[model samples]
Target: MGALDIFCYTLWILGSVTAFPFGDTLNRQAVLKTNIQTTAQFPNNTWLENIAVRANGQLLVTTIVPDAAVYQVDPTQSHEPLLVAKFPSALACFGIVELGLDEFIVTTNNWTLSTAASPPGSNSAWKIDMTTFSESSGQGAVITKVADISTATYLNGMTVLDKTAGTVLMGDATLGVIFYLDTYSGEYEVVLDDVLMKITVPGPVKLGINGVRLLGDELYFTNNNQGLFVKVPIEKDGTAKGPYEIVARFDTILDDFAFDTTGNSYVTTDPDNTVDFVTQKGSVTTVLGNKNSTLVAGATSAAFGRTFEDEGILYIPTNGGLAGPVNGTFIEGGKVMAFDTSVVA
Candidate 1:
């Protein structure tokens, strides 16, 4: 079959699956009532790819299109995005995580969504230190290039595996592998390579293993093309402590997710424009948004608020239906949404 035919066939198969995990009777079509508020909005074509929250509750948002830039958004105040810093020679910025006190690490690449391949030696990591930046003083932040990931393609989600050891795990969706980077030494190596990380079907969207996170002794991730949320016990050294387990599976594309204190995972469905709440026991519920809803539309990545005032808030950044338009026609400017998860029913 041709590529378009295969893509259409994949969608049909995905849409046909309706059984819930472990055969629970809960309706998959149920959408929970959520309290959502738009915190910030950018230009119509802006693609907000990833998000990270500073200790003081400001948001660090990244974009991949138009420019590989990072902006600092204060959710509590005017919500105007302050230009933090832009990366040089990078078309997009992907995963970002806090490395240390007010310091962060971000992944940069020259890859475009229209093309399947990125230029060799264009994948790299950089550090953003927000230590001296005071909003009152109008001081700027510092940006430094950490290391180049010449060996991989399409580095997506990231999480700090060991902070003191300066080791961060990054998922390469194109390569179907995970790389462990040592921030202190600027060295990186492939630490995990499994067949489950690869895309199951050959089509236009070939993304696999989109999101990666570490909670306690287990590492959780999402396989976008396969539509699976998986987890595996891991050591601090980035090695698996046991076999990987499939937490849940769905009929839609999966993106980045955030965990709550009670071990519930709020996973984003990029094309479906919804957030699935996956409990520790593996049951899934569509807790926020839907395929036709503009609320958290094109939600790409999410992070819970850091400060106590907004700790129960799930902050999501969207590409504004750039990936897949809601109801196949609705598209808007990229935005940041604050969902009050504590008030969700």
Candidate 2:
């Protein structure tokens, strides 16, 4: 009401914008780029846990809801996810891997800390058909019951390896172990174990392996709590070598990563987290974060499209503040965010 009060208000506004421009400012030095755009969101029944893109440009995503369905989303459509297949009595579906044309694999996390009832065998691997997205026909796109790794609590991340060997690699968040499985014979082997325990850090003990991506002969994964992107050398036999090496380290929590064709790696962090791009020479750049007006809330996972138009665009899935208290009040759930990395860096 008074002239002095008005002057003070104006100065406060200026200070706020100058100090923190974004609505949810977490990292001060990181610049939030404008090219990032939202793609889709699942509110009530759709709790998307993991995503995998097929060679035909179709996106396959798994959910944690009661029905435990796998969805196929048209890349051209906006937030429209068509339910392909639903597993009965399955609670949480975590990871997905494309096997071939109209075929894929999914890993389920039966035991969730947030839920009361747990599915039989903490985690089970299943094979599904992409065309019909069903396991019933036993002829068409069927869901073949695969191995159950009950010993591993949460089988979180998955990626397809050399198809000639019919092997797929998966990350277990509950036990911090990585397993390599033969798709044809159902044979499985542990490639890496206790990865977080092996890493020496001074902070509070946090051990969970989330995202995994295979680049050439090296396998790169994320240690969520430590905010570390680690690489392990894989032998010709498809096994990992000695201790895994830390490729890039960050202060914030990391979710998933996308590799560009040029061998550059782009990783997604928390809603208030910063983006870290690592070059082949081991250089790191913070292309997006708190410095700009664009705010990333509850960013969970990211994937790089193979096509030229979408190749460099990073597809990010957000919870949009719906997944409970962990995401916070400002951040909402069920929204997909796309960031054009080719132009940003």
Candidate 3:
């Protein structure tokens, strides 16, 4: 038989038996999709910019508003109230990563410290302990400043290397450099200096190497304004040991991404409100998202579910609402969405 025949025959036979992980008994149609729904909206956000699923299955998200705060979502309760970890007026957080035990490392740009005469406020990173956090109190959480990038051009995303040693790394969007911080000393250093990370402003779009992910022996990051996907092999200490290589290029402008066990990337296309899949073999395809759908407006970043039940699922967060290709299809303010990946071909 041919490839198409094999696919059709299989769909006609066992599609019903394998529907649990993919769907409920809503309808009687064959399991044509990997899941019954392409994406499910999780109602949490005011201007969410990034998302990371903790080992404990809590959904942690970051916001972009001046009154910015971090939030936690409980997957078990469908209508659970958002748990907010409020930040002071001077600090607004962007990127966040889990550091175990309800603790997280977050990146910040203190816009309040910016002066009308000099460069923008010096950037910094922090460790937020949500252990005894109370959304009502909104101010007593234990917070520590990790990296003080007083001279940093612009700081965006971050990743943790050694939670025990308090080692964290951040990407500079404006100066094109990578800096690692010693959480213990609260000091940071320029560890990687490469032209490949140089910032770009094409017409009106301003972005650079925004988000970085450390794979087994390599690092992958998104260069937005340049529309290039870059990857570099690194040493055990996180220093680049090889020149940056272009894995893929697109005109859509990529944002943050998460990799599956198969090494496939679930990447976000900023204003497009779309998530594109970069397969393990280097092919690119769109998974769930439409220019006109509020389903995933201004899609910013994605992370896979860590629970045994949700292992391969993808959770995407948006930068609120924006205009799509359609005449009136605009995205509403921020949201967190879960997309069924088994649906992907």
* Rank list by TM-score: 1, 3, 2
lDDT, each prediction: 0.82, 0.62, 0.64
Compose the digit string of candidate 2's lDDT tens values, residues 150-266: 566567778878666667888866467788888787777777776452334556434468788776667778877666777776775657764566666666667677676555667
Could you tell me every candidate's TM-score relative to the true structure? 0.90, 0.78, 0.80
Q: After TM-score superposition, what is the CA distance of residue 211 in candidate 1 from its true location, in Å?
A: 0.7
Which is better, 1 or 2, measured by TM-score?
1
Off by over 4 Å in 2: 1-29, 44-46, 65-67, 113-120, 132-141, 194-207, 271-274, 281-283, 288-295, 322-327
The model with the greatest TM-score is 1
What are the root-mean-square deviations of the candidates from the true structure over C-alphas?
10.0, 13.2, 10.4
What tens-digit string does per-residue lDDT give for candidate 3 at 1-345?
Answer: 345544532332223210012111111111223342323243433556677766556687886653457777655544443655666743556778766556788877653312311135557777888777654554455777766678776677677666677776778877777888777788778887776677555564456777887666667788777766677777756688877776666667677888766566777887766687775444566666556555567788888766666666677877655313223544355667777787776
Cand. 2 TM to true fold:
0.78
Native-structure RMSD, model 1:
10.0
lDDT of 3 at 100: 57
lDDT of 1 at 296: 78
**Preferred candidate (lDDT higher): 2 or 3:** 3
Question: Candidate 2 local accuracy as lDDT?
Answer: 0.62
Highest lDDT: give the candidate number: 1
